[model samples]
Target: MATVNPPRGMRDFLPAEKARRERVLAVIRARYRAHGFDEIETPVMEEYSRLHAGIGGDNEKLAFNVLARGLDADAIRAAADDPAALTDLGLRYDLTVPLARFYASHRGELPGVFRAIQIAPVWRAERPQKGRYRQFVQCDIDIIGDATARAESELIAATLDTLDALGLEGGVVRVNDRRVLDWMLSSFGFAEDERPRVLITIDKLDKIGADGVVRELADRGAATEAVEAFGAFLRRPSSADVPFGEQQIRGALPDGVPDEIVAHLTGIGDAVAAARPGESGIPVVFDPFLVRGMGYYTGTIFELAHPSVGYSLGGGGRYDGMIGRFLGQDVPAVGFSIGFERIVDLLEGEADAVDRAIVLVHDRDVTVAELVAVKADLVAGGARVRLEQRPKNLKPLLERAVADGYTGFAFVAAGSAPADIEVKPLA
Candidate 1:
């Protein structure tokens, strides 16, 4: 017998769950649209070559590759030594890579600078757990072809606005720059070739602590001086206290951290502050050690963190080199993604003004025509109407109506007119 459930790491949303998800997505879509981002979509799968093109970082390994069709057993056996030979396509693990491909394909049709909104499902081969899903939606807003800090600033502003619109106030954004990390590494005596591997270890600072990072780097046969220097820096007094400010950004890093990187981080804060103003409650933190796992991040990187969650709500960074891989020329790009599944779980169910919903509970004796007729009248009056057959037990049906976000329910008879039905508050 087939298992009566969705695949692991996937879900089946009931009517109420689907509605709640859609309601939350509506808020996100509208907010992104208001900020001048035009929604776009690409195919869910891309060529396996593109998906594994070294740009997707660790996610490429997690890609669900599709095997080439019509392969004979001989051919399959031939390719068994190299699994990639049997595959031609793979599901995207994130939106940025697809967006890069899309921009390259349609560069001529797009504006000089493109603001895009992509709210779509992405797949990864992850072990499912609470707040993590292999098949989950990602809500992304990106700006491509703009080299200045303006792109990052606009993205941050829009993100904060969308969070506020979703009633998720007090969300914090931790900011960093890839360039700062590179500079800091050089200052600490790490050689050019080893910086990538060194950064990988540095990213573990949170989980392993300073001593663990130093020990791991030393064991990995990293430069003795570089490890000791960085270890000293990490263990030094903690200067990056929050309430993100220009001074705090400076204090977080070593003395030689470049001025341009500092200015870029501060500029984003100033821009967001101007657009959102004093009333906005989100704090932007500057973390020198924020090494986002994505290797393609070129300049700035930021992650959205909330006090209530142990993990990041969402994050992204500048990957200026990404579009160039597809288009054969560099194009500045920055994006911020909202972890849709995580945010949806955190949102408290509330009434959406867009839906003034009601239910028409009709008996078996009532004609479909009559039921629909009453529903039509209510719908025309700007109410979202649903017609349900009245069960012998009315209490359960009425309770479900409330749970499904119907504000009121009315009893309808065989030929009851809209005016004749008395609507009672389901709440």
Candidate 2:
């Protein structure tokens, strides 16, 4: 006999849990749509070559490739140990890549500056951890064909609003730009080719600390002058005490950050703050070393953070060059993604309704037509109705109903009329 369970790193949600997840998703979908994003879906799998394309950064390594159909032992043996040689398609590791392909496939039908909402699951082949899963949902809202900070600002604003709708407070968007990072590295004498690997190392700064970043870079044979300069910048004295405004943004990085880069960042912050004046202050902060892992991020990058969490709630960035791989020409694009699994864990479960969800506990002898008639009447008149035969022990049955979000119950007999039913609060 073998123990049975869901696949490793995946989960099976009970009815109540499924309802709760759908509730959270509903709020997210509604909020994104309210901000003018139209929903679109893409296939879960894409061509292996497209998934293997360089744009996915390190995640391409984790893709779950499908074996080519009609393969036999002979075909498998003939391929030796190469997996890519056997696969024609792969499950998407993230929504952005498929979205790039989707836009390229349907460009003529879409608006010049299209706003899209994509909420779906993406797969990766990684060891499961407490919060990390092999399959997880990513709720993303993207704007294509917009090159300006306006795209970034809208994303930031909508993300904040969605966070509020989810009852997660103290949400902030940490902002940076790939271009600024490139310029900063160049100013420190780091060669252009060294920057990508260096940026990957720098992304670990939050976990490894300044000293660790320096030591690792030194060990990697990075240019001594560049490593030393970057290390100094990381250890620079506190602008921490200062408010996060243009002044703090200037102080955080070395002097002579190109004015246009500064202005673009400033504009995004200003627009988001203006839209959310009721907050303590601006909800966006500038982080000079905020290197999002996706290599496709061509310009501004950002991560969502809440004061209560040690990790990002979600993140995305401008990937202007991604669509070019399929479309033949580049299209300006930027997106924001919500870490659906992480955010769902952060909040408490909520019932879709309380007293409005009614359970009809009835005698088993009652005719099916009569029972369904009353149930349908209640449903039509604005209530969630469920039919349950009266069990010998009522406690367990009612308890299960309560857990399923029913807050009230009514007793029904063979002749009980819809008008005769008296609903009583279970709580």
Candidate 3:
């Protein structure tokens, strides 16, 4: 027989692990509902064209494409040179793209400002590491048709509240506006066309230090003076000194940029403070260099990072133009997606024990009807019941039950009535 194993980057969540994950997901779902966000689910796979529609940034390249099936050998040979033509569908890399497609198709049925909650698995063909996987769930909440800054504020507050409910507290939210980057680039004398490439390079500032960004930009043929000035500007102490930093940036920019951009950024800060006001409140920092790599984020962009985790717990921003690609009209939207897998990994040590009962039939002569009755009684009494045929040696079975985290056990003998089932605590 050939050896059988799961694919390299995927995992098999056994019963206990799956239960724990479902419990976490339950808490998140309830919290999202409380915030007036209705649940929505899209297909795991989307058309290749929609998946690669330029909204996903570099993540689009990681989509797992599905090749056309039932084609003859001659037909396959004719299209062998063009792989894009052969692949008609692909697994969704993220929720936002599919949501955009969903809203476009069902706009009439949805409210003008739809607040949607999507908790589903997304696939990406990236190299897996410690908390990263090929398939993982993303808990996302998005508000569409609301152009006001309140949408961003509500999404941030709701997300933080959900995190707190999950027992994961003290996360820091780093806020930045994409327009701020555009203004900065303009201030540095970078042309509109050059801003995208420069933003992509600047997005790597976290991975590659200040000097590395300058070197990369210089290598990419950016103006020497602009590169040096931008590098110096990025190194400034802005996050710690928002007011002074804002004044300096405003001074550097030409007259074209509006003051409303700064106001919007400040509003998000104030709203975040208002939403989480207290000594134990999560901190919201205004970071100038916090450019989310996604090209779809038009205005406010924020990322939630926990001190315990090396990566972001979740992040989202306003993507007003995404739906426009399909609808042919702009719909203002803002979203935040909690990194479900990372949150689960962080909470693994503190996961609550699954409360369940196992019924072991010690007597082999126990009738199937008797066992079913016992199981039904246990279940009706609000117990998670598992039925197992007991072996000659009860010690091994008891030991296995204890290791499986069963809270209690019921031993059913041959011809025992449902009322005769003896239940005992495992402890």
The numbered model that scores best in TM-score is: 2
Better of 2 and 3 by lDDT: 2
Give the Cα-based TM-score of candidate 2 against the true structure.
0.97
**Model 3: lDDT to the true structure:** 0.83
Q: Per-model C-alpha lDDT, please?
A: 0.88, 0.90, 0.83
Off by over 4 Å in 3: 237-257, 279-282, 415-422
lDDT per residue, candidate 3, 1-427, as tens digits?
7647677678888766887899899999999899899999899999998988888999998899999888788888899997678889999999999999999999999998999999999899989887778888889999999998889888988888888899987877887889888887888877788788888888888899898999999999888888878887766664334332345345444445578997776677667778776744336766667888898999999999888867788899999999999999999999999989888888985776666666454567788898888888888887877777777777787777666667778778877777887788876
Error of 2 at 234 (Å): 2.1
* Residue-level lDDT tens digits of model 1 in 120-152: 999999989987789999999999988888999
Q: Count the backbone clashes (under 3 Å) in each candidate.
A: 0, 0, 0
**Residue-level error in angstroms, candidate 2, position 239:** 2.5
Candidate 2, residue 176: lDDT: 92
User: Which candidate model has the greater TM-score, 2 or 3?
Assistant: 2
> What TM-score would candidate 3 get against the native?
0.90
Best by lDDT: 2
